[model samples]
Target: MFLEATWPLAPFVGGFCTVRHTLGVSQTPFDKFNVAYHVGDNADHVAQNRRTLDSFLPRSPIWLNQVHGGRVVDINESNISECANNQLDADGLFTRLTNTPLAIMTADCLPILLSNEDGSEVAALHGGWRPLHKNIIKQALRFFESSPEHVSAWFGPAIGPKAFEVGLDVVEAFCNDDPNYKGAFVRHPDNEDKWLANIFTLARMQLLALGVKNIYSDDLCTVEDKTRFFSYRRDKQTGRMVSVIWRKYP
Candidate 1:
């Protein structure tokens, strides 16, 4: 099933995050609704699941070969065919085309969806800590024809602060970018060298700093909710959930 994103986007824009439910074809650790073919799930099952998902979408989604970097591909009519044939190696995708859903697959990493106020442009980002530290949101924002103020962002489920622990290096990397980022990390209760990172807070801070005002979140923690999500940190071998957004065709 889907966890529909309820933001104030134009009626023509659609966005949602997929959940691992009993209705899917994947089995065992994947156990129903695993969408990524790179995750070692059966090819046929993944294909079937994608087909099932496609039935709900206007057109087949443009998936990426996410590398957890800041690269974002422009998905438009001219490059649409090439994009479908070659899963671009990038962490984000942007497109203004109608019904061309852009998807990002993740287990614990955040899935961030964006759209302009009038629903003319939409983007999907694979927001892992590496890409976030690299300011992937900032890169993705550049694709919007409008300024940051006119863009709204929807944050899908990811590893929450309480469950996402990191090292001093990670904290320093973010804080080095901006001392304000220090506020997003706190010393782990039992380990002085470790910190509990608030990815949601960090991403929100980045978006706000970039001048994006209308931000929304599902507030669901993938690590904590095993029934509805897949968490790589929690389960070493697991399936990936997808978050997608598109401008509906008239």
Candidate 2:
């Protein structure tokens, strides 16, 4: 069975989406559609299943060597094959053309997708705590030729706010950057230095800062929903899920 699942987040662009969250029965968390080659799943099986994924879309999803940074790659026909080698560890992807899918693999981190409302351009981003701290979403916003008003965004499943805990450093990262983050974290009186961070709200803060009005989020939690989603924080050796998107053609 294909382990890929569709995003429940609203207003999917022509080909914008999230893949299914699944576990490999033999491989613990890496059993199903573990698109991450670095996670120790069998390489042959990963390739075989990748072909399985190819059958669902018009072309291969341009993959990445995710490094949790804010750098974005532009994908075009000339670089599709070379990209497989020089994806050179980027955290986000953008494309103005159709047919070539731009995608990412994530576990607990947010797999973010952006598309112009008229459907001429699209992108995929990886946002965990580090990249978020570095303003990766902001980098993405700058890539679009259109104003934020003409752009729409979709956020894939990530760890829920309630389940996400951090020390004072995490809270300080945002607060130091912008005091507007004061509302995004709640201090834990009993825990002393710990705070609860709302990743969804964190995402919304950036999207709004760019004047993007159409934002859709999957309230789904990778940590809590063990049956359907994988969580690196929950399971260290977990298989990663692919959240992919491509322009649709008639």
Candidate 3:
């Protein structure tokens, strides 16, 4: 978990953001802590792992389908049952409801947790290259009444720029959106048609552009740290890590 800054929203209103590693009793690929259901891991083991995760929180988290798109869902107490019965097709989740953990799963994709000061609102985003190019961070912030300046963000573990190589089209997507994004990419030394994209840098640029002042990150690279994280780029059949954010009862 990335607990670097004294969680801008935790102290006042009792919300916190945390991440879980891929460590559980599931077999190879998933190994110990995979929380995703569609990843082909044993169903019973996945269920057990989810239960284990719930044991550490105030309540079960609201999990989504995570289509790597910019769709953000605002969850409240009223629709809690509906959300559970019908899985949401969104990549980002935010809530004002107390004790309802909003979670997003990721392997090599970036998991971002955002919250307002005093913990009145909190959100989590599953950011892959597609969502990043689409500016999902800005899209997620639109769910809250607060301005971007009043929000703080924490970036969970993901494939670092040195390990995340992308095609020229991705580079074009970013640069075409904004030329400032060009700095977030580096030409691959071996592959002429490929470039290394800095996911965190791209994310930071988006947040800052939107006027979000406080941003914290976990420097750990998922692709490089095989023991602590699961990387889709490194292992296509790997499990995903979950990052959850919620408001604690006062």
Worst 10 residues of 3 by lDDT: 14-23
Model 3 lDDT per residue over 1-250, tens place:
3323345566643333333343367888788788888989999988998898888778888999888788888898789899866889889988888888888888888888888876778888988889877778888899889888889988888899899999989989989879999999999988888899999998899999999989887656889988777788999998878888877654
TM-score against truth, every candidate = 0.97, 0.89, 0.93
Q: Residue 14 lDDT in model 2?
A: 40
Write down the TM-score for model 1.
0.97
- Give the clashing pairs for model 1: none
- Report the error of model 2 at residue 52, Å: 1.4
lDDT of 1 by residue, 64-175 (tens): 9999899989898899999988998899999989889999999999999999888898899999999999889999998898999999999999998888999989999998
User: lDDT value for candidate 3?
Assistant: 0.81
What stretches of model 2 exceed 4 Å from their correct place? 1-26
Please identify which of the two predictions, 2 or 3, would achieve the higher TM-score against the true structure: 3
**What's the lDDT for all of these models?**
0.91, 0.75, 0.81
Error of 3 at 240 (Å): 0.8
| Separate clash counts for every candidate | 0, 4, 4
Residue range 1-250, candidate 2, lDDT tens digits: 3333243332434443333443232255576667667888888777866786777777788888888888888887787779855556889988877767777888888888888766677888888888888888888878789899888777788888877789889988899989998788997756877898888888888889879888876567889977667688888997777777776542
Once model 2 is optimally superposed onto the true structure by TM-score, how far is the C-alpha of residue 166 displaced, in angstroms?
Answer: 1.3
